[model samples]
Target: TAAAPPRIFPQAQHFVSKEFCQTEFGIVYPPVISVSSGELIEVETRDCFDGKIHPPPNENDNNEYNPAQALQQMKRAEFNPITGPIHVNGAAPGDILAVTLLDIRPKGVGVT
Candidate 1:
């Protein structure tokens, strides 16, 4: 069977990174990306494990730790990391923000 063609968003500005993430906080952080009102943008994200839950290629690999341990560490660091708090230029307080999800393509197969 043939794979379906990937969805295309011509006007979307793409953004992806494992760097700009945050845990629960009392104050808001700065926006990672800025877009104008009504502009389309795509932000790539990883699963809650941040792509670390799976085992390494070799069972003997000492680098990989247990999933529980990894989860604990991530909780202490930053749990449930999301893409961004995308800033919409000219949007003010009490203004509504609309988000439309065009597509979601998982990167890899996993048991989680």
Candidate 2:
């Protein structure tokens, strides 16, 4: 007799959601929210600034600038851009979507 086939597991789809976790000092690290076919979750992320603020390399900008203006500039570039809205093949409205966090890694917080 032939050997029995191994059990199969269903594959999960991923969706990239955005959240304004925080914005300080001209640096911004947007939140990364993920959703699968069965749940809602928040994924771990590194600081978007990566310690590149304070003495902005571009144009040698100083700290004297308005915080709001600097933040607006960051926003203009659409900082912390999200990945996607991946729709599962069979997902529909009112359907349960289970999003789970497989892993998370975050770095220093943005300093204004």
Candidate 3:
């Protein structure tokens, strides 16, 4: 069966890279993008290895893939490169916000 076309959110504030990724949560790291409450947003994320893990170089060379290599080369003391600083409007410290998933599409080239 054929796949559906990617969903587009014309009103969504899109974030499609790891440029704003942070290892730890701190005040010094400001929000990369901010939007009002109930606003749609899109965030593309990297793998937990910070993109160190990868598919084999060739179709026949599956053994070439190694997770330990990626882990050793990671920069953060923690796992998963968290990308966000989305400041939601009207969301105060004491208030709780909820998120709804409209759709999730896997893009090209996932780590094997």
lDDT of each: 0.66, 0.42, 0.68
Ranking by TM-score: 3, 1, 2
Model 2: residue 18 alpha-carbon error in angstroms: 11
Identify the candidate with maximal lDDT.
3
Candidate with the larger lDDT of 1 and 3: 3
Show where candidate 3 strays beyond 4 Å: 1-8, 11-16, 59-65, 75-78, 107-112
Tens-digit lDDT track for model 3 on 18-98?
Answer: 557877777788888877876777776666666666664776765666566765676666567788877886788889888
RMSD of each: 6.2, 13.6, 5.8
Please estimate how well model 2 matches the true structure, expressed as its whole-model Cα lDDT: 0.42
The C-alpha stretches of model 1 lying farther than 4 A from their native spots are 1-11, 14-16, 25-28, 56-65, 72-77
Clashes by residue pair, model 1: none
* lDDT measured at residue 24 in model 3 versus the true structure, 0 to 100: 73
Tell how far residue 3 is off in model 3, in angstroms.
23
User: After best superposition, candidate 3 residue 88: deviation in angstroms?
Assistant: 1.0
lDDT tens readout by residue for model 1, 4-107: 33435556665544466665443378888878877777665767666767654467766656766765666545546676766789989899878888787776
Worst 10 residues of 1 by lDDT: 1-10
